[model samples]
Target: MLGRVLEEIEVNVLASQAWELYRTLQLAKFIGEELPNVIEKIDVIQGDGGVGTILNIIFPPGTPGFSSYKEKFTKVDDKKRVKETEVVEGGYLDFGFSLFRVRLEIIEKGEESCITGSTIEYEVKEDAAAATNANASSMVSIQPLVMIMEAASNYLMNLKNNKNKM
Candidate 1:
């Protein structure tokens, strides 16, 4: 089974400003600092926030099933303001998912506004048991990504507001 979930939020900031955060590992750090309950920690295993970068992400202890997973940055397009990552080990793979990938994009809307989009693409193992495949399909969700985008939008807006006060 193949599945995808997409969510987007508009932020009152320039696309370049939003991309400054989303285009690199700073977004991971922001998530760790802002959403402690959703993500416990993220450690860089290799690369420097660019294509081929590997990240080992750890979920909070009480997370429903998997605790951690390693993902690799498969695409980092600066001109397009997009980044894509794929799970290379653990996490959803253990639940019978053959492929789990995430793509984040910053779309320019206006001089002072932009849209932050998050997408999750996954495929369940074709030869896996029915239950496992069913379970894998069930695990696909956009809530977590939605939360991240909302938080990031708020954070960037706050920063802009504070800077304007100076």
Candidate 2:
């Protein structure tokens, strides 16, 4: 059986009195389609709830995972955008070498969104080893999404601020 460990982090950002920008920008399509600096396109969206969306990506210097390729979103759902999005994601990485299961919850707080997120990552082994070691699958997971989240947050607030000023 595979074992699991947990990690969670919450980030709160204050924009110009509107949290929609922050919440909406977190969506997968908006970043790859609307944002100017997106690395690639969003091809597959997994999971029934808003918690999962996958983007076909190119290798960048800071991309996460055991390989240069990565899945753009591991999990995303902010209540500020749609009022409430609750879901959990569980999957394995390339083989028994790595695995992950994450849960993300977003709460709106008057111009700010309280994002409470948790994830469990561990080494996968046994029968799953060979299957995961193959070429990148159509379904992928983006690991270490901290930087993307930060950029999206900045873009959200700044874009709104610019629009309002004009």
Candidate 3:
């Protein structure tokens, strides 16, 4: 069966700033510097940080299930602040998923606020459907990513707030 999930979160940051973080390779830098607890490191395996870019998203040592996965950037749209990534190997596939993909979009709501939306698409192998469905709720967890984004946003906001104080 095919499964699709969509979730959105609002952050207190300018749309342009949020778009830049989402569209370019700066996000890797942010995560590495600001969220070392959640994301160990984001290594670019191939291509530039754009369409066709491959990334190894490594989790911390004690992270559950698997350590990392290779994801290919399928689409990158700066104008719309959208990024699409597909799991090429490891991670979810290691858990027996036939196919899996994720899309992230930053929608501008105002001058200082934006909504980050995530869409997950997956297809399960018929044989693994039963087991997959049973543990599905906890299977595909984006909690870490969400946390990282929130922390990054807060960090940027703090920088702005602190600068204003000066």
Model 3: CA > 4 A from native: 131-134, 162-166
Q: Write the per-residue lDDT of candidate 2 for residues 1-166, one digit (tens) a residue.
A: 4443333334444432223443332455555655434354444545433334443443334534432233434444343332222122222343434444433334444455445333333445555655555433223343334445555556655765787799
Q: What C-alpha lDDT values do all the predictions have?
A: 0.92, 0.41, 0.82
Top lDDT hit:
1
* Candidate 2 Cα errors over 4 Å, as ranges: 1-26, 30-41, 45-58, 61-92, 110-113, 116-123, 126-143
Question: What C-alpha lDDT does candidate 3 achieve relative to the native structure?
Answer: 0.82
The Cα error of candidate 3 at residue 86, in Å, is 1.1
Worst 10 residues of 3 by lDDT: 129-138
lDDT of 1: 0.92
Query: How does residue 81 of candidate 2 score in lDDT?
Result: 34
User: What's the alpha carbon RMSD for model 1?
Assistant: 1.1
The residue ranges of model 1 lying beyond 4 angstroms of the native Cα positions read 129-135
Task: Please state the error at residue 124 of candidate 3 in Å.
Answer: 1.6
How many angstroms is residue 141 displaced in model 1 relative to the true structure, after the best TM-score fit? 1.3
Q: All candidates' TM-scores?
A: 0.96, 0.44, 0.87
Q: Model 3, 72-93: lDDT tens per residue?
A: 9999988888899999999888
By TM-score, is 2 or 3 better?
3
Q: lDDT of model 1 at residue 165?
A: 100
Most TM-score-accurate candidate: 1
Candidate 3 scores a C-alpha RMSD against the true structure in Å of 2.1
